[model samples]
Target: MADPFTSALVRHVLGRLASEAIEEYGLLRGLKNDLSALENTFKLIQGVLHDAEMKQTKDKRVEEWLKTLKSASLEVENVLDEAKTVAMIKSLAGEMGNKYKRRAFFSYHMNPLMVRFRIAHKVKNMRKKLEVIDANRSRFQLTSNTTSEDSAGIASEISNRETSSLMPKICGRDEEKEKIVDEICNQEIGIGHDGDDVRVYAKWGMGGTGKTTLAQYVYNHEKVKTHFELEFWVYVSAVFDIRRIIKSICGLVDKQLDKMSTDYLLKQLKNKLKGKKYFIVMDDVWIENEHMEKWGELCKALSCGENGSTVGAPLWL
Candidate 1:
């Protein structure tokens, strides 16, 4: 009953729906992997804390092990954030309804699906490693003391007290925070500087380098907050979804995502951002080349402010 154009549109929409389902599956798998990793890490930390000799190490091995656990936990949090980004992308892809060119849709959506799957696989392997560490720590705890109840009770009490204290205050990277904030303040400012080109500041570090925390601090600083008329924060993890990013920005500005074409949404973004100095932070950036290029397209959409207008783009990887 439909015309050729309408039938093609329906096929396109169905294809996009299939892609969204795939993305959701991948994201759910990634979340499972992350949750498993967190559980193993928690068990490992608990086992380590229960060891009597852990507190008596001369090489500070226990401290180093605790630090590794903290880093692993942060990585799990980052993985969860990535899963959320993938879900948002999937949702936007379904809503966009084949608006993007076929090539753009495939490039932006299908390619990142591979990245998410690969990362999920890696997280699963890491989870196995954490489980092994947990087992070893548990064995050490069991064999360390088997004959003395009084001594065991005292050791257990001491371990429990120490863990209670240390659990609340996980180790963090202070120097990294200082350096990142300095770079963002110095390189990501556009309005006050006498430069013609927009300032683009990028922080490309490893996964657990505290990029998100560093950016959060810089984004909330008094000086940084006062410099830009409008500020936008976007989480562009491995799954690079432009429509979702736009929708998120709209939500932040208290706008809805319905009843807008890609072009219309972009226009609204430009109008909202035109002639006003803006600070944009893209956090937890993808490390892959393809994902990075896809993110560039999102940036291009947001960088269309009027000529002579100032825009600060700070990307933290």
Candidate 2:
């Protein structure tokens, strides 16, 4: 799959595509409504593209959907760029000769209508493609929109924390991440029974030993994600509720569990996770088998009892 065009670039260009220049241009009169519709549709897809692009590696349909969106957006960019260039020339038509006037007239009054019609047709087809992708989102197990920036500030905070807690790259840990990655990649990671989940793995040291950072390094490693399709990070802290842990996993995959019975929830969770590789990092697990009973049950459900197995990784406390 092609490396996804960064969301930042799309957001930046789309912002200009929906600019006031397009809205106010007198020559774009017949084109305004279609341009506006295209802009709205683009906006609608922007939030979901993240999710789609994330799954593109796993699903070809998502890959195609993103490609289509990118192609349409690029065409819009080109059209808008042309319109801006024409508008600039038209503004100076008085200084230029009749040749320039004719050019400006064609650009403003005639060319825009054709541009508008073409874009509208493309956008209408793109909308149909989007509808198909939307209808099949559940087939990919997308429980919620993973790519939406629900809170820009919070996202920045999390990004900063994950990258280095707002610090410079002075305390690099490439080797540490590699070590963890090697350990994880060396084994077969899958959902399975207790015997399969019995690997003794733990990161032990004194307080503030950078265990969390080291664990996160492994968790976010590209190889680690390749080994596991479903990834979850839950900060266990002092409160060790198994239900809470299970809920966090469900939230990652966007599974609804409200008012459901325990057996039902487990069954649904198992069905949702069946045949897929998943990763769960129980941060601050405060080592105790007392927490194991519910954890064991979760393990069983995730393993689906029959077709499951597990690969072990460092469990930080």
TM-scores for every candidate against the unseen true structure: 0.40, 0.40
lDDT of 2 at 68: 61
lDDT of 2 at 170: 27
Q: Which window of 10 residues has the lowest lDDT sum in candidate 2? A: 157-166
Q: Over the stretch 86-141, how does candidate 1's per-residue lDDT look in tens digits? A: 66676677777766434444674445666566567756765775565555554333
Q: Which residue pairs collide, candidate 1?
A: none
On a 0 to 100 scale, what is the lDDT of residue 184 in model 2? Answer: 62
| lDDT (Cα) of model 1 | 0.49
